[model samples]
Target: MPHNSIPVIETKRLVLRGPEAGDYPDFRATFSSYRSRFMGGPLTPYETWMLYAAEIGHWQIRGYGMWMIHDRTTDKPLGMAGGWKPAQWPEAEIAWIIWPETAGHGYALEATHAARGYLYGRLGWEGAVSYLDPKNLDSIRLAERLGAKKDTGAQTVDGNDICYRHPSPAQLKNTQISDGIELEIAHYADPKFRPEGYALD
Candidate 1:
């Protein structure tokens, strides 16, 4: 399907969809938490909603934007993971951030892997990019696991400017990964993207 025509995606334990007005409070809470400290200072509910609305608006204008990730069972939001084209980056950036309480559960990686595949596989994009802070070990590791290279070049945006890249598959194959977890990019635009028992609030 065309990129713009893609619908919500469902994963083993999550659901990926466009942002809604209802997401403001959750997003505000997530942004204020310690997990998101590196993402810039906390934003007010209105600011959070504005940012989210802009993301949703991207789908209409750019045919791509951030997709909110939520738990399928409890219907709680984990965070957002998908394609974004912020002005600072030269190419479309693949980004994801889980709420503080939800950290270390592999949600970011899972959501990101699926989003990347959708970008390259479904959207037919030539390539994708991810700009990360080198000191943010979690994000760095996640990017590496996805086979994304470190560009070394930095461009400041939202108080951060650091390594960036579009990693090759060979790079991914060469990396050693531990057991018990595997990454898959969530494709939100696919019709089959819904997780079991998922419902929008």
Candidate 2:
């Protein structure tokens, strides 16, 4: 698919869409902190810029990549959440990162659930995994809540991250949008690959 045609996903409280240049400030702020320790950060400004550029490039090259998450109400960028599969990855992975101030309100869980739904429902993926740093307790907990279990046999390219395998579409349960919340998938007529009929919930 053409990069510009990347789909935008929406949920009750957030929008998961393609990365934009405007998201750089939040990206820089998040990665410049110690919170980024597990995400290859505390990077130099130039490096951060390159990382942002790489995120954009990833979508162009892989058809599916991370989405720039936004607070639907405030229309502000919150962080990123979606599928990722760099060259050396064992499988496509579901990933998320929320800005520090926005932490703990279930945004990660909400966005990730929506992203994983898109991957499985809209994209017909059998499953996905999350490469998590064992020390990142919060992520571990979130992965567990999302029904992802550590795949003891799997390893990352860097050899340090543990893989958490997510449930397949058939295993997902109770994922309906709650009252006052909406989930929208952007329409794209000529996607490189048409999705087979699959529903996450």
Candidate 3:
């Protein structure tokens, strides 16, 4: 199986797919700008390059990683959302990032919902968490909107970040997400690319 054989998720207005070479420049610009402040950014060009490789490499090493979000019709790159966990992290996380220019359209929320559904329905995760900077109020609100609550008891990946635990699968089933988005996750029951649940190796 390809390292990034990750599923493609479609929302009402967005489409999330595996990362590609074309995605680097947009990611590079966003990551190097003030927009990526909360994500430990304003990084050097070399660091940006390495991080891009690492994100793609994540799928190779961990079997699950962030997917690039795009406009459904224009196919324009928006941002990224999905599960993430590094060796030093205490737990797996469902992370999201949307460019500041595209901030107001609720793209992050829609992509995140699709990502959460994949984590539960396809990957069989018991639950998920999102680690955020305490100052990132937008993400905090988005987390809450997605039915995630602050988990003061949970350990953070970095000393500065805070944890927000997402609702359980049963709880998620009870809450209504965006209307009319058919999140038909691809490759169901296909083991060629088994997503080893969000366990840190």
Candidate 4:
């Protein structure tokens, strides 16, 4: 797919689509708070704007980057989730950051599962890793739940970080629906890209 035609991924309760200019407020909020501490945040608005722009630019340059996660039912942006591989990174990585209000609702797990599926199944990636800060226990636990094992020998651009290797495509569990939750992947060429099973309208 062309860089502008980046795919949209949907999960039971969330829709993962390309970042928009409007999402900057929420994105900035997350980065400016203590919640962003692990992700190298607590930055000034200008810095946050630069980071946000880089996220949008990543798709143009790298062909893949983070998606703006939105609540499927309410169309409210939650945060971002998708593949991240900067020039200084060791390998392609699946990363996620849920907004404070949505932090404990399992949105990250659901959205990430869909993101990884797109990365491995659709993108033909052999595998990907998540570079996590040592003190980010929440992320570490989430990685464990996603079947990512600690790759102690892996090296990261930041010496203090550790790598969590995700399971291969064959090993990923099918996205199971529970409590009426569903997942969908959007195609760039389709104007009617929204999938059924969720009230995105």
Highest TM-score scorer: 3
Best candidate according to lDDT: 3
Total backbone clashes of model 4?
Answer: 1
Per lDDT, what order, best first?
A: 3, 4, 2, 1
TM-score of each: 0.74, 0.84, 0.85, 0.84
Residues 113-154, candidate 1: write the lDDT tens digits.
Answer: 667656766677776677666567778777776666676554
Q: Rank the candidates by TM-score, best first.
A: 3, 2, 4, 1
Candidate 4 weakest lDDT stretch, 10 residues: 179-188
Clashing pairs in 3: none
Report the C-alpha lDDT of model 2 over 1-201, residue by residue, as the tens digit.
566798989887788889988889999998888879889878888988898898889998888989998888888988789988888788899999988887755677778888988989888999999999988888887787677889999777588899998877876744543211222222111244323553121
Q: What is candidate 3's lDDT per residue for 24-123, written digit by digit as tens?
A: 8899999999988999998999999999999998888888899999999999998999999889888889999987667655677778888989989998
Q: Which stretches of candidate 4 lie over 4 Å from their true place?
A: 1-4, 173-201
Where is model 3 more than 4 Å wrong at Cα? 176-201
Q: Write the per-residue lDDT of candidate 4 for residues 4-120, one digit (tens) a residue.
A: 588888666678999988889999998999989999989999999999999999888888899999999999998888999888898999999988887655677778877887888
lDDT of 4: 0.80
Error of 4 at 51 (Å): 0.2
